[model samples]
Target: MTSTTDHTQQPREAEEAREGEGTTGTGPDAGSGAWDDGLIARRAAAASATAGGQPVVPLLPAPHTGTPASGPDGADDDLTARLDALRELTGLSRPRVDAATLAEAGRVLDDAAARRRLSRRHTVVALAGATGSGKSTLFNTLAGVTISDTGVRRPTTSAALACSWTDGAAGLLDRLEIPGRLRRRPVQGPDGPGPLDGLVLIDLPDHDSAAVEHRAQVDRVLAHVDAVIWVVDPEKYGDALLHERYLRPMAGHAEVTFVVLNQVDRLPEDAADQVLDDLRRLLDEDGIALGEHGEPGATVLALSALTGEGVGELRDCLGQLTSERRAAARRIGADLDAAAERLRPAYVPTGRVGLSEEAREEFADRLAEAVGAAAAGQTAERAWRRNAGRACGTPWLRLWRWYEARRTPGTAERPPGGTPGAEATAARQRVEQAVRVVADEAASGLPTPWADAVREAAARGADGLPEALDGLTAPEPAPARPPRPGWWPVAVLAQVSMTLLQVVGGIWLLGQVLGVFTPDLLPPVLLMVAGILGGPCVEYGSRLAARGPARRYGADAERALRDAAAGCGRARVLDPVAAELLRYREVREQYARVLDPVGGDGARGRAGGRHVRVTELSTTGR
Candidate 1:
């Protein structure tokens, strides 16, 4: 048995105050807040009432919300949970699913909640049909009184009328908006107790009436009723308006529906049977299944209110429905099924893909390429070589190169040879393409609207990315030209020594020619040859040594630029795409919960493992 000790621990006055926060009046437009408060209060009171006894109810959360509380039964919980899931799913899918598309679902939930809160014990059944269909006659026969006007009228029943077999249904009648004068109770006879003790029969306005308000009234009352008996005669049984507008759309509501062939007494026995068979065929075409071959579906019966042919059978069915006290729940479940079927396209997908590692890596690579990382590395290597030559070459050559640079028109230290504007434009294009690729992959197989939303998010994230990348690669004072190596001075000194030897040799030769000194020509010539050969060798060695460090410096520059590019891509595009995907996943789960009632696959009319099955209503009086 379910326990209510935790709930009972709270003071009664405090609990009442909390539950009564927003439920001052039970008006027609009170909305769902009043229903929630009423349901909570009733469930709490019921739990406390049965706590001391051996209650059959199991410990479960309330149906409307997932809050842990004692509930009446699992069937009620399942219906409530599915309704709650649908509401939440609709909210989560906003901007993707328009509010206008979900108007039917909203009405279904509001009506179910209002009905469930009013009175679960009473089974509210509506008699609905076209004008001159003998619905009022059948209703009067069922109530055993002349309550409704019956004649050869073109249109009747502009307002709803109610007849309760027992008392204490004022709340339910009020919810249906039935006028006080129109509400009636059956007079007690010598029979001790009637079969239908808690039945609330409603006579609705004619659906095919010319008056628009009468049709609107029929629609409003039908939405709130627990079950409906569609009364049709032989001629109008296959009317296209009735089938297309009502029967076809409510195919999921077969369990709570009964198709009656009224005025059968007007036809011969053979003709009556033929009309009934044809009516069954028409129902089949409208997607309403009959309880044939042991399957639970709608109950079809041929009857005549004038002769009282099948009134007893219909009463027995209503009696059974009221005794079980589950018609309201079954009807609510069917409404949920119909609403969910309409919404399946928006929430459920054929298939989908996620943000993969390969996609991210490819995006990063494209960004690196866009920023010209390879070109930057090559430039760094060339810069290193030029700086090294300036430091280690002979002083005269270095001075001449500097003078030549000053003479040139556009020889100032710049980053590279490319046009800055052109490179920036190409980089922007690559960045945009990368963003689109990743966004498409992430949104694959999603609904068209949601996919558009994901792509929009990616576009927003890519804004200003090109300018950011340019800032990272922009030139900034040439990095102070890397410090000279320790061995550079040794090479410079060797070159200077070679120059001194050549100078001294030339002077000696000149003096010899002038007869000022007695020197050999061989020594002077040999010194001159040594200076020429040594200078070239030193310069060659310096060039060979600079290759290793230049390569290392180029590699470092490439790695730093690539890292910056990858970071910018992640911050701008990838992260936003991932967030949108996560949100879609969350809403999808909510849809799944709404799709299934007993948390099984959402097959129509299958409520597995529940105490109350979805198709049990059709089999109630068989």
Candidate 2:
């Protein structure tokens, strides 16, 4: 390695020599202003000896940003609480989201918990970049020691190397899985204290490594770090893989990010400036923030680890950041935001879903038909009429009806409705169809899982309903035999009188024939005619009275069937479906709580310290 002093002094010597003489000398010191191999080696050696056991020189000064060092604060406590709440709430949403998504979020929560528990005192920051990006060199230079090996190997930084400026970070490093040998304590120069007092710096493997394990390692650690420094060299500054793969996806992590164009000393002064501007443009296109005039988005720095060009400026920025010590919270907050965004779809609004009246009524109608309720009701009406006729009609007619009832098939025997045949089959089909309709209706506005559950519930309800329906026999006294009217007895007496009148008429006629008359023959004949006519009128009145009871009987039977169908529908279909819907409602409400921003007064600012709100999901399930 060429020392900075030697390389810079060579150019100065040339300018002086050229000004002093018209001809330049071709020697080791002034040959085209390039240092010879011997001179470079000697300078390197002299520099090492000149250190005199002293620590590396400090160029960057502490920033005056007044950001506090990492310490216990109510804000962090509140943020942790909010994070716990978020994790718990997400668990409740397990039924709605896929297993993969839930597992991923669970990992995030677990990592956050572990990191928080390990050490909130040390802000873990990592330097990550593509191969040959000078990230390892920068890390070693930052620590002012050779902890991570640097070389021309394809991937020099194989494993993560950590450097901590403060104590109590050993536990944290162990958790990161960084071996103790690769860990180093930063040089605390004679300047009393450095700006990165409680900082823990890491050099991670190249992000786009050909080796899968290397890339996996990068991903694993990136999730746990408090902040990141993206080291990009001049040659690969505009690489889309860098921006598209890592930078763009981490848009929410801008506040805790630094985009440094490492090895900028390789380029000329003007070229370096152009590269910086162009890189910022690329980052902008990548949606990685470039804070307004370096306020606090992605702080861009142009630094050279070998020459220490912009290292001081980067140190100053990081110094301010470390002083504030909000990177851990900011990083964790950004992660939670990402998780919430990913979970957005499950909570999409669909409003409310339920069974419509028309659907329920249709379902009941189908079941009613399946069970032959209508036929049974009509049968009941006929049975009532027969019974009423027997109780209130003339004795001769009653005897004839009794004989007829005995001959009738299935009279108060099996199912009141004759049999389960074509009508029953058709009814069963209709019942199944009705179940589908009700299920579809109830599931209309619900999410996919809930809708399926409702349909299942409806099917279950239909399955057990057929037999229950067919077995419903109309309630007994299976007949509606009304009491005999008072007029019935009077009619009986009148009939007797009529019979007597007829007998008298016959006797008188006979007497007349025999030449002896007891009463007038005309009067006896008139009486007989009246008695016969009145008897028919009384019997007709009794028949009319029986009609009302018969109709009521039919109604009662139909009602009983309906009650049975409704009970089946509720137990099998409605109740189960309702339970599923209620579960959905409960989860939806939990998601609603998830949607609400954790309204802590000062415990948490917006993620990235930008005034941004998470997109709240509508409850309508659109």
Candidate 3:
């Protein structure tokens, strides 16, 4: 059966009156003056009604804003602004305070207020260990009362117990999530050495057991408590589950840890020391500090909770530690350090090569030359005319013209040299070859990836050039409108009549020459002159009829070539360079965001530097 005790101590009426009346002082009375202890206690009780009768707020006052009352509350305002700035920096939609930021806030709170609440200096030491480690006996011995059930039973201490110091250190109990409803008792010494000031000894349930909820409770309260005392007995000293699961994982918190070898009375005196030494060595190997052998690691003490041999020393040690107020800061600092490490990766720079302005300009220039926009347009005009002439006119017609220019009056055959159309065809081919050569040369020096992209873009741009040029150069097949019906036939009939007249005149002249007809025949010279003139007239009219189609074809071809050149320039050259430039801009923006100290929100001052206090709020509880 567990021993239970009731604490009947109550706040004195005179002390309560002093607490109700607010005063400007830096002592315990300050917490009392601003807040009614009874009211706070009642509120805590009401809040904890749903959670297994556990008070959420306990009797602790809210942490005070330790701001100074000078310079128009500048320090208080500054802290508020800084916190707001930090909030903006994180860009968090919810109140997601990291461990580091929480620690920083705690430090700020510590600096801004005086120690008016005795709880500020108090430490909550929880005894946590595996099952069958004799932790119940240790708890009872430490409390100087049989507060927990310790027997030969397989399991003990199902619920937690709170052993408080009589030095009015109830605030620490509240911070640790221990309620006033928990059984409390005072520890006594042979001379009744005054209570272990500001220490709350908590006897927690076995962490490894069938009662999983009991273990969860221990974990939930561990975050709020100051220090932890892990108890282990000789039989379970080298337990793999305990060391691997708890001791090794908490190696970073070497300062506030206390490892005790309990039930040492079961071992021989000489073997007890040896086993204790071995346990310390094992902890050291697992990265836990042990004694002063290394940097002040966790202190190892051999104790028999059953015999109560080391109970006084343990109590004295707990008192001294609680008085120093090291546990809260140490625990908070470790959490903060871990959080800071996690944030480091977010600021690291990713690799990217930077491009210079001169390089970009050079690339642009090369691309401009490759497309040959201006030159291609001019060359296309001449090439289109030559190709159109050969496609529309007959080779024999060209041959006849060449012969007409070279042959003397009575020549029977044409000259050996080819017609003008042949020379024009050759010239057209040369122009196309030149265009290809210039385009290739201009695209030669670009970076491979960009070069490929530009080439692909140019090819897509020029895809329609061939069809556009064909449409532009196609000859109009529709016949020209005849001069009104009657006039067009009359002109054709008149030409036929003239040709018949000439033929008749020629026949008559031949007859006159043979002396078979009268000597008054039409002159052959006149007939010949008429035929020659008529041939030139017909040729000129034909050329006049075809002029519109030829002009239209030439215009269309020129437009097509110009469009193709423009498309190639845009896709192959301009687009790739522009994309590269845009990529550089994106990279630059990302780097700027990482390096920008003020988070780019137009906030005041730099982000990282020595912190300056902005404001001091009234520490008096409202």
Which candidate comes out best when scored by TM-score?
1
Give candidate 2 misplaced runs (Cα > 4 Å). Answer: 1-98, 145-153, 191-193, 263-297, 301-313, 344-351, 356-358, 381-424, 456-463, 471-553, 597-618
What overall lDDT goes with each candidate model? 0.70, 0.64, 0.49
lDDT of 3 by residue, 327-433 (tens): 55444333322322233232222322223444444433333233333334444444444433433333345568668857756664332335746744543443344
* Candidate 1 residue pairs that clash: none
Write one digit per residue (lDDT tens) for candidate 2, span 1-622: 0011111111111111100001121111222323222322333343345365863221211211222232343343334333434544454445445677566456556655566556555788999999999888898888887777788997887888888888889877887888888888877888734788889998999998898899988987887788899999899988888876788788767777799999887899999999999998887776665665534566888889999998999888878777766676667556655665565455444655666677778777877776667877887778667555554455445567678888985665354443547666777787777778788888887766667766877777778676665566424452244545455566566556655766776776788777787645687577667655655565677578767867887999888877787787778788877766655554454343333333332233323221122232332432
How many clashing pairs per prediction, in order? Answer: 0, 9, 15
Candidate order by lDDT, decreasing, is: 1, 2, 3
TM-score of 3: 0.44
* Candidate 3 ranges with C-alpha deviation above 4 Å: 1-64, 68-118, 167-177, 188-195, 291-294, 343-622
TM-score to native of every candidate shown: 0.76, 0.70, 0.44
Candidate 3: minimum summed lDDT over ten consecutive residues — where? Answer: 1-10
Model 1: per-residue Cα lDDT over 1-622, one tens digit each: 0001111111111111100011111222333542232333343354444655743222322343323222344444455556666665655565466777666667776766566566556888999999889999999998888899988767767789999987778998888889899997766578733888889999988999999999888887887787899999989999998988888776666767789999999999999999999999888776665765655567799899999999899888878777776667667666666665566566555464467788889888899898988888888888887887877776667888889888995876676556967878888899889888988887787766668878988999989988888888987785676657888888889889878877888888888889888968988878878887777777889989989988888888888999999998888888777766655665565555654444333233333222122222212211
- TM-score of candidate 2 against the unseen true structure: 0.70
